[model samples]
Target: MLTVKRLDIADARILIKGASEKANEIGVPMCIAITDESGNLIAFERMDGGKVSSAFVAQDKAFTAAAARKATHEYNAANVPGNLAFGIHTEVGGKLSTVGGGLPVVVDGDVVGGIGLSSGTPQQDMDCAQAGIDYFLQNRG
Candidate 1:
């Protein structure tokens, strides 16, 4: 038998709340996505004025983070031309992202989920995603 840990709906809400707060603070409405360890969607939010096209992008980012167990930015770094890892974003039906807005949610050194944000510059999105993970860590009791 195998045991697995994953995020639930309440956890997803916490991630969204934290990410949205950061987005509001940064004056960038965003689309936030939370996914289970297996990259299954748990919850999603599109803040007011968030770009409609970003909805799916945020989800894909989260999927890449959770399923790959690494931040999307890390992939971006390794996905440059002539690198063996290049073109990885073309995998998983083009769902894998090399963008900077995706982060794996880790608890006790275990990746339990992921958070992703879009509708802003990549740096802003990355900040919001980190904020979500910070909030989850501080409030997951």
Candidate 2:
């Protein structure tokens, strides 16, 4: 049987810090969340000026990414047009956001968690997420 490694609180904190730094650099507050492979929340943070509502949105995005084992944006884009699964997000308790800022957190090339960021423009959100991922990869080993 194949075994998988999961992200821990430390990992989540690292990602969150990276995301927060990026958001601060861009002068945008952000809400960031991390979830396990089963879509359970691991850790989360909301910047001082972040939208209060974005906290839930970040959790939803992380849950959707981890549960689907794919970046939410990719799922959204791939399932558009003739794909019935495109609506799956709606059925998943409406906890999914097909936006660009949610990404699966992979370890050993396998998705073990997810990271989600909100409270910025879509592109800025994505950039913050990317910064977090980059930090994880750089410091993980």
Top candidate by lDDT: 1
Question: Model 2, range 23-137, lDDT digits (tens) per residue?
Answer: 9999999999999888899999999999998898889888888888878778778668678666766757788778778888888788889999999987888899889988988
TM agreement with the true structure for every prediction: 0.98, 0.91
lDDT of each: 0.95, 0.86
Residue 66 lDDT in candidate 1: 99
Candidate 1: clashing residue pairs, number: 0
lDDT of 1 by residue, 38-77 (tens): 9989999999999998999999999999999999999999
Top candidate by TM-score: 1
Query: What C-alpha lDDT, on a 0 to 100 scale, does residue 5 get in candidate 1?
Result: 89
Candidate 2: C-alpha RMSD after superposition: 1.6
List, in order, the clash count of every candidate structure: 0, 0
